[model samples]
Target: MAFTIPENLHPDLMPLAWLIGTWRGKGRGEYPNVPGFQFAQEVSFNHDGRAFLNYFSRSWIIDENDEIIRPAASEVGFWRVKENNVLEVLLAHNTGIAEGWVGVVKGAKIQLEMDQGYSSPSAKIVTAGSRLYGLVEGELFTSYDMAAQGQTLQAHLWSSLERQSEN
Candidate 1:
């Protein structure tokens, strides 16, 4: 099937088209004063000639050797460009927050602001957070800062990847 994006959307988003597929890679993450956890994820990016790239990610718990153990929860979202080069994303899941964000996109990097996310089904709340994404030398590099777990910034997940066949 042809993955060529339609011509009408903003051309600026074209560079990110390289990431428009399913990616499987190992990831390392950390929390406040704690050792990092290891996981593998499948991140899928899809677009239908719209203003956004549909996003979905599912992770797996891994063993010490970075081998898969079992399936984990996931995140579902939409990533798009807003007015004045602002990038925005909205994500939802059963285990995680329903999040909304605004940001900017650089060549291979993105800086985002987390505006709102669901604390719970009943307790809806807004959050303060920033996300950075860049492709360094070939690997995917990203960092997230959020107030969800007591207003802190941490290097939650990091990965160096090669584009492989989709899951």
Candidate 2:
């Protein structure tokens, strides 16, 4: 579907208009400390005529039959965009980690590096992370790399999602 920038979007958000919608897709995850799993993910980016966009994501483990086997993870965050293309993203995870990212958005692509992170003593130490997001042929493509569990930065998650809501 053709995407039209929302008329009510703040001028500073024009560069991020492509991300304003709901998306759903499937993805695979693998890591050294955990067993690999297949998951169904849904992510949404929306704004209430405000200066920032509210972000939410949830994932569920699924079996071969595509039935949800168990809840996996969830996160809530805010993406703040400035007129100069500076971006600040703050996210809190159910795993007891909170991360703040700062970077720049160029056109439809975004690259963010972790600026600060805090975690509960019970949470795994996630010291740093970087994320990239872009739109390709109407699909939202996203990937993240992180340093955790004494492991160096490595691919942590990726997903390709189709738009599920109108522009």
Candidate 3:
């Protein structure tokens, strides 16, 4: 499929043009002390002729039949691309956690490592985290590893999302 760059997008964000759209799919998540579960997710990225892209993601717990059970996680953030393909991200989650991440973009793939994080008094502290995003066979594939609640960094979630048609 051919992707056209949004006409007014900042030149710094050209490399990330492929991600400027909405994507939806299902994913599975598991962590120590938490029951494994399936979820449906929607992620969207958009730009406003600036150097950054706005990002938003929401997920809902789902049953074996792919029926929604309850709302899960949600987050909003911004992604900025700097010189040398350096990427910076700022994210705030519904769970009262805010994080800063840094990484580099290698073509269609990006790897991010947590740089800092803040947790509200009642939220769990995430000691470390890493995320990988890539385009695989035209689908967006994402994976996350996290260290939290006294556990070491390990796989926590993964999903493959197909781009949604522009309305």
- Model 3 score (lDDT): 0.94
- List, residue by residue over 1-167, the lDDT tens digit for candidate 1: 12454455446557566567666677777766657688887778777766678888788889998778888758898888766668878988756468788888767788887777667755424356677777676655656655544645545566555545422
lDDT (tens digit, per residue) of candidate 2 on 27-108: 7777787787788899999988888999999999999887999998899999998768999999999999999999999988
Off by over 4 Å in 2: none
Span of ten consecutive residues with least summed lDDT in model 2: 1-10
lDDT order, best first, reads 3, 2, 1
Greater lDDT among 2 and 3 belongs to 3
Q: In candidate 2, how many Å is residue 103 off?
A: 1.7
Model 2 residue 23 CA deviation (Å) reads 0.5
- Per-model TM values vs. the true structure: 0.80, 0.94, 0.97
Per-prediction count of colliding residue pairs? 0, 0, 0
Task: Please state the error at residue 164 of candidate 2 in Å.
Answer: 0.2
Cand. 2 Cα-lDDT = 0.88
C-alpha lDDT (0 to 100) for residue 18 of candidate 1: 54
- What 10-residue stretch in candidate 3 is worst by lDDT? 158-167
Give the range of the ten consecutive residues with the poorest summed lDDT in model 1. 1-10
Tell me the TM-score of model 2.
Answer: 0.94
- How close to the true structure is residue 80 of candidate 2, measured as C-alpha lDDT? 93
Give candidate 1 regions above 4 Å deviation: 1-12, 33-35, 121-126, 165-167
| Candidate 3 per-residue lDDT over residues 47-133, each given as its tens digit | 888899999999999999999999999999999999899999999999999999999999999999999999999999999999999
